[model samples]
Target: MSAPNIPSSAQRGKPSAIPGSSPAPVPGPNRSGNTKTSAPHQEQSTAQSPQLISVQTPTGGGAIQGIGEKFAAQPATGTATLTIPISATEARPGGTPSLALGYSSGSGNAPFGIGWSLNIGSITRRVSKGRPQYQPRSEGTFARIERVTHQDGPGNVHWRVTSRDNALSAYGRNSSSRIHFASKGNKNIFSWLLCETYDVSGNAISFVYKSEDDQGIDLNAVNERNHAILRGSVGSYFSRALPPLDFDYIAAATGERIARSVVKEVDWESLENLPEGVTGPLYQWLDLHEEGLEAVFAVQGGSWFYKRNQSAAGTVSSLENSTLSRTVTLEPTKVVNRMPNVSDTEKPRFGQWDVFPPFELWPSGIDIGNPNVRFIDLTGDGRADILITEDQILTYHVSLGYSGYGAPRSVHKRTDEERGPRVLFSDVDESVYFTNLSGDGTSDLCRVRNGENCYWPNLGCGRFGVKVTMNGSPYFDRPEAFTQKRVLMTDINGSGATDIIYVRSEGVTLHFNNSGNGWAKVEHLPSYFLPPIDTLASITATNLMGNGTNCLVWSSSAASDTCSPLKYINFNNGIKPHLHVKITNNIGKETNLSYLPSTTFYLRDELEGKHS
Candidate 1:
């Protein structure tokens, strides 16, 4: 036969068959059954030998592609490498989750594709160069959104978010918009905003979206209660900035350093009229000034109150912690002289100083402006309350149940008195009187009294004014003289009608309400019915054992004693109740509101300034 034209290791002048001393010289026959190794293929023990790995199968060219180690002679060890990848959203195999190797023996000892129980759950490594990352085998890669935050406030809200990815060269941009009214956490779940306008801040590899929208619509109840409409506003005011989420997107474009810039007073406005169909809370402004005096008014819950400033001057602004020292005296500076739009419904029927919530007078030393103070329940809580007004500001004070007054508080603030529409009378001295003087079920208030007035000096606006009403309609024509001092009221006789106690030029006169329109100054009682009272505190009607009928209990600074003390007296029949006539049975001793202090142990607070 002619010489076969087939290519072989010998024909190509290359060592094949696993290339290591010719496979340790496998036995071969010399054209016979017996075999012998070729001389040139014998293994040699030399220090110059090269390290070689004998793969089970010999490969042609690419069977073992990129490894470039030339073998001169067989040595001891070998080295080879295999690789795989994992992508985002992709996970490794469940059962073995491990990487390993495998082997096989076949043609001339080449590696069997890197044996691996390695099931190598396919990982999507970046298919292109430059921007490489591990992703889900399904789509190869994905983008990231980070540094998201939503700040909620009473007025408006703000949001911040960023879209990013490992591949700076990715073709698409990231985006999302959402509105947040409350707090929410981030997990697999995320939220979005509405009515939002976005302003892009950074690049796509890490594009940031900062958005804002008004939440006034959410605080409808607050606005209405405050008597103002919180319409959509142009800007927002934040107390502080929301902290960043991703620690990477810093200046390095990582998540960490992405900070939210701080913003300040975008000054908000409350429109008086709300758009139609939009229902809001009950917003109403009430005039709380006393009958003829300049007063400050404020609404607390369901009641109206006034702030008692030192000078009884004009109001200025509202306060944060009304309980604090509310005595911000206007220093006599031209405080805004705004007054009450005193609707017939808002004037003070200034109840009896005792029946009203009372506050301690600015005592001898503490001067908080107007040392002259009076008591009346502006909020109708049955306590002797005080309404203090100054600089157009109003405050409310209720008894603290501890024989003292609570911290006068003003919830809201108003700066300029000029902004409001009413005018206050700085000089009128006629005190107010609220009572059911007539047998009628409805009560009336004679806040301002004037019937052809002349006497009472105009200490303030000095305007001689008159006309009083209760619950709106005019009740009666009270003479200016009747209001010179507070008018006391009670059912004097067994008659269930409300009567009036007037102190006139003549001693004290008792005007008995006929329960209708006429007033009869009854002189039928004992020769001396009225007593000499110094400074009366409170007056309560109760049944005293003396008269065997309902009577009145009262406390006052004793004529001979500076220490205010309590006393009791009854009227005619035990049939009905009226205020007590204290001067009758008392000549000396009575327990006071405060406990007497002992010089033996600790000194009493009342014992500080004066002795009675």
Candidate 2:
């Protein structure tokens, strides 16, 4: 067994020993051959022999296994060891070698038999899961390599390309270039990015190419980041471009129909029809409803109806029908007052008839056609009169004359002094009276003075001095001097003269004046009896029950004997002593009344009197 002569081909560029080869002898310097030649040249006959190593082909084919005897015969020198350096281009498409073999051989001459076998095995190339390589079909063409980056801060690399020209142009103009088509491929554990970028407007434009197939899993991740960047940039661009987009305009443009169910759910019963040509905002419609427009148009038309604006030329009749729905009517030639026509020479008719003013003409009073004003005499001669009261100052027009009525005109307008014409009788203290006291007139001027002492037990005393006029001359007379404590004057004596009845706390005192002069106190029996005096306590002198004599009836507090138990005292006697009568409530009703002597003697009565 000899060591094979293997070449050191692995060290550098050299060949190893052949597979079947024997070691060859080393040639050395022939010093012994030269001595032998100098000694007489004994015929040096080196036997010329053939080299042992040789190659021979197989004679017949058999069951071929392993290397299949392909290397059975070959010259050993020719089968030297070999080492081939594989270039990147020689590698497989997926960056893997298709076949690799390393071998060595020994040098041999006389057919040195060196045999070896090789088992041909399949090789699988492992591809990475990343961006694939972008192959350019044509030369001088470029592929765009787009990469997107997402940073933590506000800035984001929206769309970046590998080409310096594209990036520079895009940055210089601050604009985005269009993206052509892009495709993706999946590797074992990554993805491949194959993209093409070209100019859409130019004919001679070239496409840029990129190959990222060999890239690892990071390529897929980069692709995902790029996708997110693209989405965000697109969204931001759209948002910026469409600013101030009103939803109402969009809805209207889209012509969205309101839901019928929503309309039905609203409270239509409360809605009122609106006038034409009026529109409202959504909030106004929701809050005010259609009636708001109707009211506005009504006010604009100056009536409770709808009408055209001033631009339309229409007649008064058309305007009336369109602007008004109802009209008001009034009466004329109405009775104001009535009285016995008395001569001017006959003492001016002591208690003359009163004339009432028309209600419409009276200031600060009830309106005309008011039920309360129906009692007013529309054609009264004293309509021009004016009443001055604390509550209000009223002016009346009767026969178009102005006279003082109701509360008396204060003598000194600026005087704070209490000396003035005041009403002698009134239900409430400090209240001014507004009624007709002179029988031959309309509503007259009157008022009741409130005295501080009037409410006190013994100190409550006041006087009303009336300045009467005779023949256009004023005469001073104290009608309330003797009949001071709450008195009323009327023709109670039937002597054609006025009398006064003073309502005192103990009883009522009757003062009769035969000559129409001041009264003199007259006391009647059973004067201690008085009626329940509430707010309705007043005296009325009238021909009640159709009697020919005037009667005096006074109402006072039941506990205060100032009055006679709400009874009538008749003075029909053509003599000195008048008749004393007692009246009773026929029933609990205010309208029913009876005489105490007998119920049959009671008669329905209409009491007419005057107040000042």
Candidate 3:
């Protein structure tokens, strides 16, 4: 046979394999009979070194071809490239190999009898046969190869194998080749096989074959089931795996299972009852139901207590029969006011005082500036209670109850001590008296007839007069007394016991009973600057500064420019002795003055040396 020669064009550029033709097997005798051949022919084996299969066929006047090999002799270890070439004829001396069957002409056909070349690049080998391998490539190989197939005569097939792998692994042997060709093992099962088997909707997955039929399967239900399984199998794994779900969402998704579980685990009865119109989690119900529970409490207390109907207004007669009772009654009586009485010689003595009036006072009767007293249930019992004060006495009568005043009783004979039958008065001149001094709790009765004439007038001119204790009764020893004067009871030293502040015309004295005996004098200010003996002076102790023990005396004298109307005197331990006085004119204008201890006395021109 004549040796094949390369054409001039073939010499300029590499020629591709002929379409519908395979490379000629090495020309030698077949060695399949287990016999040794010549030295040059010994290298060829009948097994063909697992030769790669390639096929090509003509379709629509064009060729279809496939070019592949058994990867490398070994598994592809790393990245490799593959290249293939195709042509209608092989360029050589005399004649080139050509396909001349019923080939249709097309625009896609290559010139010079239709040559084609493909390049595959960067093939990486993954786990296969538990070994690292790679695909091979030829020089100037493209990044990818598109396969085309062709058919030959009598259903015959042919292929043109690529030289890319051979070129790229030129220095390597069969097993060590750096380049390889595509193979069945290179396909990823997960990406190609399993992934193709499923249809995707958002994040959910369904069988591709059954996707249409299972379109209505609730994904939420599947998620809940998955969550339950995962939460159970992995010890609360779903709690960590999934985003936290709201309680209501969980309950709705799980269809009462979550609620039942929570109910079974939680103490429902111990929790407060939920309010009306409230739903969902117990905590939400509790929060929403608080006002409803409070309303329930109010309703249970009484229908009349919080009722607003006119029938429920006025007099709630139903309440009287019920636990609720009226708290006050009124009666008509003659009013009187008696002055201090004279002694046997008809001289006005300090001891023999007259019986004050049993005034028919209104329930709201009191001076404008004085504290008011009203008939109220001090002990919370449903009964009428009596409260008496200097300006008013309230006598509650549930028996003859009315919204206004009740029935009156006949005038009964008064006790000798009372001088005649009369309404109880808080400012009785006698030893025993009752008043709501601090405006808290019930009215307290104070008696002052236990000590001796330790009430000497020279000790201090009693502006409101003094009452000597007649008997040594401990209950009456302290003589809880209140004049029209302002008295303050406080424990300045922080002891549990209380001390008394007695403000009189002469001075301000603090009587602290350190041992609960007679009043021991702790502080005695000879006098607080005032207009005169009686100028409607009002004294109050207030802690103006934030310090715990510093007390300031707020006092007001006669409301005139000549009379200092307001004063702030500091009575703390460390502050310099000074008095801040504010005077007001007849028209209610004011002036302020700061008086230190060094301030000299001011002589009044009208009073003649009596310091003002």
Candidate 4:
């Protein structure tokens, strides 16, 4: 679908499909669609509208309007969608759920369902595992926009639904003024517009309310609240099947639904106007049914930071220029801390040291002076120490607790090699290793002994070696058959023994620790067997999913169909690379990304963002 044009009377008149909605007979073509967005009211103050479509007030003149005060001007600039989070059962690292559906086993327990339009009768017939097996349902309309409510009956909004045989049914009444649409899919999520009925005097008698379809879970359960999304409009009435729920309904062009099922509400707001150009939904909240929490993540620009249990009215206040989403993020981290930049020594104190700004472990000059830099607590002081290994000498900036970094000290030195040393452990029992480009550089002296050096710089010299050490004591300096390949030292199996993994454009090579002895052998994991992870902006392998082995994450600018801008190389049993999935959050072009060990992968989205 093209970007949605700003919502206006003109746009409202055109038919729009309500995704993730109940399968109802939509009443027409593009121009005659049943769903409608209210047109912009004649020139009026954006803060407040000139005319108040007020429900009966005690004084009868006017009382400030509330429900839609935030989303009054949603003449949708473009159609938007919502993604409700399903099962995070796949959240890596120990089966911990990133987002989980409700789970309570009983006589009838099903926390997974989809927005569907099924033959109500058929669902009552067949049984699966002793339970009725229902077909996939859809919240899509089958009614035409052209055949609209030509007339308003005594108490219902009526439309004609023609069958496949051209047999037109009479008076499609919207009895429950609002046909409550529910999604039993994995979560108790449902939505409906403010379709209300006013008495002759304009008093709202009832609204379109949603409820649980089968299990009959309490719609009013604590921590359970609905977000009244500004889903355009539905003409002046709702439409559905006339009497019997039989045939399918097809209407306007539709869209795929979002799957973030959790959300948090708040009071303060970001004054920045809503952004345009994006094609789909920017979810305001997600309701994690299993965590028993309503949450919203903080987005400075593109990267998202987590925040929990935010307060929200779940209503939008529309304006002429943009919709005043009654949603704001509360940054619990330094991202929004208003404190001035103070020296590390002068920074104000916080409950936990982790609450401070993300500490810049690598100082300013490192990037310009060295290419290979790693942060680890070499002294095991619980503070991350910086290690720079660009040249023959390694420099260390030991952590000074909360005070600052200690002076840089020349710790270990090694022979020439294209790559720097990689640390396997940070304790007194440290194991550091690096590739030796030459066996003592003696081959360069023997220069092109066979012209093979012209094709392969380090060929036949057999000088290719992986030098290892325990606390700087040499372990292995043998010839490496697979030299020049990217080497990464990580504890792949989580067995406390550091291992080596070799990476090449074609595939990857694994060298596990043989009984804790270094680099004993190798296993090649070919590329054809894995998803294509094209030219990468960055790549980090860690137990992000916490499934035991390592999960590789990379940023792909090419963003092929299989690879999203933010791609995850998810592992199956923590041994070999398995499947690949994209993070749905819109983290635009990335600047930097790193794995914070164990499971967290930190991403630096658009560095220009003012947050912290």
In candidate 3 the C-alpha lDDT for residue 368 amounts to 29
| Candidate 1 wrongly placed segments (more than 4 Å) | 1-375, 380-384, 391-393, 398-428, 433-467, 470-487, 493-498, 504-508, 513-571, 577-612
lDDT per residue, candidate 2, 234-256, as tens digits? 33333222112111101110011
TM-score of 2: 0.22
- Among all windows of 10 consecutive residues in model 3, the one with the lowest summed lDDT is 456-465
lDDT, candidate 4, 1-612, per-residue tens: 121233323223443333333454543455666564442324333464334442332332332221110111112321111122332223222222222222111111112321111111001212122223224244254532222432333222333433333333323233332222222222111111222222222222222223433222221211111223457776587744222211111111111100111122222232112111111233233332112232333454544334433212122233222221223333242233333432343324322222344345434565532335665545433455666653345566877655656778774432433222323222233223422212211111111111011111111111121222212111121233333224465545333344555566676555544322223434555666444534433344543333234544333334342213323343332222211112112122111111111111111111224224
Best by lDDT: 4
With candidate 1 superimposed using the best TM-score fit, by how many Å does residue 402's alpha carbon deviate from the native? 6.4
Model 3: lDDT of residue 316: 29
Q: lDDT tens string, model 3, 399-429?
A: 2222333332222222332222132334345
Tens digits of lDDT, candidate 1, 483-572: 444345655553444555444433334445544334553332221433343334333343222121223433333444232133334344
Q: Rank the candidates by lDDT, best first.
A: 4, 1, 2, 3
What is the lDDT of every predicted structure here?
0.29, 0.26, 0.26, 0.31
For each candidate in turn, the TM-score is: 0.22, 0.22, 0.21, 0.28
Error of 4 at 74 (Å): 57
Top TM-score prediction, candidate number: 4
